[model samples]
Structures are given as C-alpha cells and as structure tokens.
Target: MDTRERYAAYAERIAGVSPSYAAWARSLDDGVVSVLDEVPESKRQPELLFAVARRLGADPADPGALRALVQEARPALLGALTSATVQANDPRRLAPVVPLFAALAARVGRPLGLVDAGAAAGLCSIPDRVTLDYVVGARSEVVRMHTASVEPGLHLVAEASGAVPTPAAEPIEVRARVALDPNPIDLAGPGAFDRLVEAVPPEATDRTALMREAARATLAAPPVRIRGTLPGDLDRALEALPDDVVPVVLTTGTLVYVPGADRQRFVDRVRERGVHWIALERTGILSGVAATLPDDVDPADPDAFATASLDGVALAVSDPFGVCVRWLADPNL
Candidate 1:
C-alpha cells in the first residue's frame, strides 16, 4: 500500500483498539461521507474510503451508495481533510515550536520564561540551544532544538521514583537553567521509533508500551525545584509571584486532557496577567477552543488568550509524535 493508504489503514486499526479513538474516527468518517457526494468520480474509491467510513457508522459494503454520498459531501470532506492534516501535524505534540516563543520574547523585549502547564516528564523543557539529534536510517538530523531558558524561580516537581521524600512546600527563589551537555538521550532506540511503534499494524507487540517505559527511565529523572512553584496549582502559585516578575504560561499535551471550560478559564487567567502565554497544546483542544472564540476576536492577537485585555499570548501547535511545529502569534502585539 502507498503512504496515504498505509496511513488510512493505521487510522482504522487505531480506531479499533481504543474507544475514544473510535469516536474520533467515526466523526471524521461521518464528515467524509457527508461531503463525499460532491467529490469527483475520479477521486472516489469506495473500498479504501469505506474502510475508514465504516468506523463512523457508514455502510462500507454499499460501495455504490458510499461513492454517491462522498461526491455529494465533497466540500465538507475537503474541509475535513484540511482539519485532519492540521490535527495530524499539530505542533503541541512536538518540540520545534517551543523556540518560536523565545524568538517572540526577543522581538517583544520581554523576558522569556516558560511554564508547561501539563508538562509530562518535562521532556520538551530542554533549552532551545540544545539540539535533539535523531538518526533515521543513514542520515543523522536535528529534529528540533531551542536556546531559550526557563524563568528564574520556576520549580518542577513530579512523582519521584525512589524514596526521596516529597517536600512540604515548593522551593523558592532558585535559578534553574537547561542542561545541554548531557545531550538529549533517546534510549528508545531508533529515530521516529516511538511513531513507528505507534503506527505499527495490528498484532504488533506492545512496543509502544515498552518504549514508554524506556523513555520514562531515560527522560524522567530528578525533579528540579526553582522559585517555589510546584507542579500542581499553577495559577495559584503564579499569582504569588512578586509584582516585578513577568510570567509566560506554557504547556503541551496538557490542555487536551483538561476540560474545555477549565482550559478557557486558565487561558483567561493567563491573559489577565498581561504577559506572554506560549501554549504548545494538541490541535484538537486548540481547535475546540478556537471554535468558541467570538466572531470579532482574532486568535492571532497577543491578547487572544484573555477575555478582555491586550495581554500578549501566542499559541504553537505540535504534532502528535512531537515532531513538526506550527506557530500562531499575535500579529497585533
């Protein structure tokens, strides 16, 4: 099968494995069917398309009807295709978009400090200066790297491995810098190994799980405490910051996990601060939030994160495998 066909098959298999994913696949398939009627006959391929459509309750066996439906729903299908591409290439899942925030900070003459709201193991927290090199086949390439620095007084506390004893309170007034010397370790073996494992056809050994454990071992190490900010209660912790300090709220893979209302509230709070909010979150969550924005509101504005203010905020979407990066900055700011 060709690349697109393989991807379609992978999507189908993934849908079968997870119910949540099945729902997403069904939604997309339904959309595809609804717009299929407008699609040209040359583009119609009921067998391949129906395999995908069936996941969303379409009759895959009815090739004739499916083709007719596809043609009738071409416009919506086209839109769905665009959305899928965007969703597939979301920057929140990747690390390349992290540096754009630093560049923006330099442009705005503001101090660059990152707060990863849903920082899972803080793997993407590495400074922009450190290049994450990955080997694909014979070529060694730099996937993405940034030279940006974490803000002063930034503390990251996660569940420790051994019995180090959790602290009573978060650490305060500490200067934490990204370590580049150790080099970004992959321990997961090959480049794109995680993605490969994830895209593997059915019956593939639980390689993804194994890779996760290995990544956890290599990536999740000692938690750092700086400036008294703990992982939990980010908003409350940030509010206590000294008046002089300007904060940039950032997160990736954490926003989608949060409820829609809660995410909006968090964004609103970030805007209230009148500082930069760099969010590297899943495209799905971003799209959902963007849909709710007022028609007059321009998401590209620096104050877009806030409900009623000019506070600067920027969003960068990352891909699911954490590879590609797409940035959305406030043009007005």
Candidate 2:
C-alpha cells in the first residue's frame, strides 16, 4: 500500500480504539504523508509517526499535529524516526492471555521458564505475578496468579466470553524470565519508561496510569534482557534459563515484524523444543492456526484484531491489547 492507502487503513484500524488517532490519521494530507515518506516504509507506520511527534511534544489528538511538528522539528523527528518503532509492550496486553497462562501453568505443574521473543521493556514478562480481572457477561471477577514473593503487581482487567470464565488455579511460579529484543527498553534508564508510554494513544489516559503502575512493578525485578529479534534468538534465550523450568515462549504482536517464513520457523522451533508457545498475533500470520479460527472471523480485516493461540491451537480472538477476549476453545485445561 502507498502512503495514502496505509494511513487510510490505519484510520480504520484504530477508529474504534482511539477516535483521536483515527481522525488524525485520516486527516493527513499529501504533504504530511510525504514527510512520512522521508522515513523507510517500515518506519512510516502511522503509530511511529504519531508517536515520534507526541514524544517531540506534538499534541497527539490534534489532527494536523504531525505537519506542525514537521515544520518545527523536522531534524529531531527524522533523527528519532531513524531508530524508533512502535513499542506495544503494555503490561495490560496480558489480560486476555491471563486465562491461557493459568491453564498452561496448571497443566505443566512446574515452575515457569518464560522467554518473551519481542519483550520491548519486559513489562509483560511477569505474567504469573500479575492479578487478572475478567469481566463476564454480567459479572466481574479477579483471578490472581501471584505467589507470596513478588510485591503487589499489575492488575489486568479484561472482559471475557461466557464459554471461558476466570479460572480458579494455584499461583504460578516464575523460576526464570528472559527477554529477547533488538532494542529492549531499559525501564530503569533515564526517560526509558516514558518512551514505553509514548506508544499508548494519547486519548487513553487510563492506560497511561496503568502503565506507570506496571513500570514500577517491572523495575523491581526486571527480566534477564537479551539483545536479539524473534525466531533467530529463541534458542539463545532458552539456553539462558535454568534446567528445571517448563519453558514457554511468548510472542505478542512480534511476529508481524518478521518475514512470513520466519513466522513458521519460530513456531517450528518452539515445537521442536517441546516448550509451550503462546502467541497473540495477527490472524493470518499463522497459517495453521488461522485455519482454525471460527468462520465469523476474517484474517484480512484488522477489526478481527488478533488471535491468541496456545501450542498452535486457536484459543480465542481478542483486542490487539487483550482488553476484550472471546474464548473459542477451552483454555486447554
């Protein structure tokens, strides 16, 4: 897709999620998109452009903010665009998968060895330590996985489907946590936590607050951060873990960053290692899993959002950030 089509599609993608972003994306005139052309196609994504502008002090919801930023801070914007990518490391992203993690943890009956393939700031790495709140049709309940060791942690609230309500399970133990990313956000470094918050749509004030809370919890016990990207770095990350853990690799919106073939390779490697793989990615990205999606879901439509799969089985389709989850198959319990 050209710059015009790309932004137009982005407008539709986030329309329901962020009205401000939707409006701003659709309002991008030729000149503004041309400024986006200055960066490579991958970096030209609406999220990157808008986020970079916001980081540079542009009002996020303002329709023509990018144009103004380009006029005032072109050099700084371009310099930032040279390296910055959208960081969807929101710890709240774990909400939808909280149930899936519970089922997996119960089945394994061992301490977890977590390897997050694209763990931006390692925020979502503490899956077992966080508290999960599931909103069913008419009732809301909390399912917590935290042991006595970790401090009060992330409280993830997600509306769930009727088929799979919150599970009552034993607390999951995290023996070792490792993260692999080409550029992992150093949450403890100067201004590092703010960088992660920049990706949250400016209209989302609630998420911003939750992010600050999550950051504090993550800083308390950060992951053993490694430097690498998906599929290629899975083994190296696994090798860093202790031998007693039930290894699990997590890929949340990370597969889209790699090529099509690498996606399959990553799945293959996970199976070969016999470690459980939990994927929350775009629908069609995984051919086998996509085929298993209910007929009503369409991989081509961004509105289908994302699919959450466990070990190649289609588990549920949910909001990209896991705010709303409709269980397709039982949590594999």
Candidate 3:
C-alpha cells in the first residue's frame, strides 16, 4: 500500500525468482542503497524498476512483488544513504553502458565521435580503446590529454593480437595544434571514490586495472587545460567541424539531468547541423504491468490476441529503465 511496503515486496519477489540476485542485493553498500531509497514515489514506475532490478539479477516472473519489497524497505534503505546524489556522479558506472552505444554505432555503419554534455572528468569523453577489441574488432588511438609536452590529438590505428606496435610504424597521426583539456573533476569524497572502485568488474585484468588507475590519477590531478561547457554551447563545437566530417553525438545517462529547454535547444542545434547520429540513454517513469503486460490478456486464444507492435518496430520499451537505440540520419547527404 505504501512506498516502503512496495519496495519490500519487490525485493522479496526478486529473491524468490533468482536466489543469486539475493547475494547481489546483500552486497550493495549503503551508498548504493541510498540511491534506490531516494527515488521519488511519483517518479517510481514499477515496470522500469522491475526491469532494472531484474537486470541487476531480480526475478523476472513476478516483478510487482519486488516493487512491493523495495517500497517497504525505504526507511532502512534511506538510512544506508551516505549521500544524496545520483549514481552518475561517479563516471565509472558509465563504463558498462558504453558498449551498448558502440554496438549501436557499428550497427549503423558510422564511426562515432562522442560529445559528453557534462564531460565531467572526461570519463566518457574518449571511448575506452579496449572496448573496441571485443565489439569492433580493433583498437582506437588513445588521446593523451594529460600531458602538455606530448602533442594532443586523435590517433587512428589498429592493433594486432595482444601487441602494441610502434606509433611511427602504425597509422597514428599527431595534430600539434589541437586543444587539450588536462583538468578533469576533483572527486575526493569517499562515497564517490568507493563507487568508482566497486564498479570495476571481477573479470578486469592487468590492462583494465591500469586504465582504471590512470583514470583515477587523472581525476586527482586534472590538467589545467580542462574546462567545463554547457550542452547548448556545443553549437560552436559543431560549426567548427570540417565539411567532410559526419559526427555522431552520444550521451549516456547524462541527458535527463539537463533542463527541458536546454535539451530541446541542444537537439535543435544538432538537427540544424545535419549531424549524422544522436545516441542517448534516458530514464522514463511508467507502470510495470501496463508497460510489459501482453496486449491480449485472453488465455483462451493466445495467438490471436498477441501484441502486434513488439516485433513490428524494435520496441524494446521497458518502463523505468529506458534503453534507447535511435539515430537521426543526415537527410541531405
């Protein structure tokens, strides 16, 4: 009936479906729990919450039950909240979601050039070169933004199996005049730092460990060149692009934070530029049953009553967690 009761029911139902998820639920720290607790009841849509919870290993069969459990556990969960902040405040959380964008980019046969609106610490500024190996079957040139002595520019190259060839011999190109931002964000609080640490998957290897470490160091000692700019200011950045360029705009879990007017203006700016693609992931509130339930509830004639829109369009609509894969192709070219 109440919010706390609803969350408790949700958790219980999830534990019932997949016992493994119970372990993950228990493993979540107070900081993480705090995030779940603060989700406003008005914005809390059962289906999206269920889908995300399921993806986090909650039972899929009875998502409503999980919703009830979480609702009931609200106070205890709130007590666990170390800080009142969104999880995206930490950049490492965005790592897992990057591949979805990359795969989508590759699917449409377009090379991606990312524009991070918040661009905090540039965590998502440059695509992690390692992800390309698994999805795109290649490596990207790592843009060195930390050092002023080293030329700042984009490198375009392919790596052989488990080997890093000399930059001179490879297809690497250096632009001496390109601007570089060395300063990122100063995330000194324990809550933010711990989240970054916990986000690293257990399967991470020596290279991933090194990369994460480097990212941490960069955050600690950001380059003086680093600067913060609003999403609307990107119009100049877009206009400066060369005539031959086809840019793909991407923001992961960042768009929703922007005010509606800014978001609309940013979209219009991109559209006016005739940009090739715009990819983003945003959260939307919706009811769990209404969003996921089958169109035809009639058990007697299942096939005849089945939904038509599911297959017609790649309508992978989940209520709370909106995983969007859309692109606006340049109509003129």
Candidate 4:
C-alpha cells in the first residue's frame, strides 16, 4: 500500500484506541508524509512518526504543527524513527499468562526465573507483582489471581472466554527477573519513562495511567536487563537465569518485529532448553502454533487477535493488548 493507504488503515486500527491519531492520519495530506522522504521505507510507520512528533513537543493531529516540527527538527525525527524500538508496553497483556507461571512453578516445585524476551523495558515482567482480575466470557465469571497479601497498588482487568486456568493454590515465586532487549530502557529516569508513555495514543488516559502504574512497579525493582534480540540470543539469555529455578521465557507482542522466517527458530530455541515458553504474539505468527488452532477461530484478524501459546502449543486466542481472552487448551499440559 502507498503512504496514503497505510495511514488510512492505521486510522481504522486506532479509531478506538486514539481517535486523535485516527483524525491525524485521516486529515494529514500528502505534503505531511513527504517529510519522511529521507527516512527508510521500513521506518515510516504512522505510530513511529506520531510518537516522534509527540516526543518532540508537537501535536501530530495538527498537520501544520507536525509538519513544522519535522521541518525544524528533521535530524531528531530521523534519529528517533530510525533507532527507536518503541512498542506497546501493555502490562495488562499478562492477565492471561500470569496464572500459567504459578502452574509451572507448582509443577516444577521450584521458583521461576523469568526472562522477558523482546521486552521493552521489562514492563510486563512484573505480572507477579500486580493483582489481575479476569472476567471470563460474556456471563462475566470473575477470576482473581492475588500474587501478594499486601494491598496491590496496581490492578488490571481483562475479559476472558473459555474456562479460566486455575493458578496454583500458592502464590507465584519469581526468584529471578531478567529481560532481553536490543536497547533496555531504564524506567528509573524521567526521560525514558516520558518517551514510553508519550508513545501511547495521546488521548487514552486510561491506558496511560495503566502504563504509569506498571512503570512504577518496574522501577521499584528493575529486571536484570540484557542487550539482545530473539532466536540468535535466546541461549545467552537462558544461561543468565539461575540454575535452580524453572526458566520461563515470555514474548508478548514482540514476535511481529522478528523476521517472519525466524519466529519458529525462536520457538525451537525455547523448546531445546526445556524451558516454559509463554507467548502472546500476533495470530498466525508461528505457523506451527497456528496450524494447531481450530479453523473456526484461526482466521481472526492478526492485527486485533493473538495466539497465547505455551511450549509451542496454542492455548488461547487473546486480544493483542490483553483486553480479552479465549482459552483453547490447558497451558500447563
């Protein structure tokens, strides 16, 4: 698709998430996009451009303002777009997978050493640190996983389908928290935190608050951040985890950035280590897992739906951001 069509499609995708961005995408003319002529074709994404504009103190919805900002600070825009690895650090996505951690820990009879693969600042790595409420199906049967007795400062909710997986009777034990990213973000500082929050749609205050809460949790006890990417670096990451604990590697909404052909290689790497792999990746991202999904539910739009897999088997169909879930198999099985 051309630049015009790409923006139009992006507008549709974010209509609910960021009406301001949708409006910006729809209203921006050809002249606005021409500013990206010098950037690489792969880097000229709507969200990336909008994030760059916002981080640079400009309103992307206003074409005149965004264009002016880009013109005055072209180098900054180029640097941000080319090198930035901004992603949706939605901690809520862990609602469906948190229980699995408990189950795995119970099965192995050891504490878990979690390595967040492709983690952007390890935001989702704190699943065990938060209280997640899952309201199952349309009937709304609620399931709560309380990881701690202390009053949790962070509570997140997601609607789910199918039977909610029962966590172990005991609370989860996370002996080691580590994350692998090409550039690990340090959330203790203000600048990195602001840039991450700004990358979210400007008007979605609800999600913005969620991001803040998760950020605070991560900052209080940061993960052992490792500089790496998937497939090629999985071995090195696993080696860093404690030997006594069950190694749990999780990848959420990050596989799409991995070259399409290499996704299965990452899966194979996880399996070879005899580690538990929890993946909340775009639907059909890994052909082996997609092949196991029943046809009735397999064709859901990959942009909106994701396959939650454990140990290379698809367990549920979930919203990419963790708003909803539909379990298909027992994750611990």
Model 4 residue 274 CA deviation (Å) reads: 2.5
Per-residue lDDT over 1-333 for candidate 1, one digit per residue giving the tens place of the 0 to 100 score: 433343354355455444333333343344444454444432333223433333233443342443445556555445443322100111223233334443454455534444544443344443332222222222433332332132221111111111111111211111222211111223344653332232222232443443343334324332232222223355553554445444555554445445567667666666665655555443335554455344655433322322211122323332334433233432223
Whole-structure CA lDDT of model 3: 0.35
| TM-score on alpha carbons, each prediction | 0.40, 0.89, 0.37, 0.88
Candidate 2 TM-score versus the reference: 0.89
lDDT of each residue in 1-333, candidate 2, tens digit only? 688887888788788779888887887776677677887766887777888878788886677787787777878888998788778587767876666777888888888899988898888887776777676766465444323346757877777774673464576677898989988888889989778877778778888888877777778778999999768888999999999998899888888877778878888888898889888887787998988888988766553588988888888888666787778877745
RMSD of 1: 15.7
Indicate the residue-level lDDT of 5 in model 3.
49
lDDT, model 2:
0.79
- Per the 3 Å backbone cut-off, how many clashing residue pairs does candidate 3 have? 32
* lDDT tens per residue, model 3, 217-312: 445333222243335456544444444434545444444445566666655666676653323233231122124334533322212111111101
Superposed model 1: Cα runs more than 4 Å off: 1-94, 108-111, 132-232, 239-245, 287-318, 326-333
- How badly does each model clash, as a count of residue pairs? 37, 0, 32, 1
Please report how far candidate 2 places residue 158 from its true position, in Å: 1.4
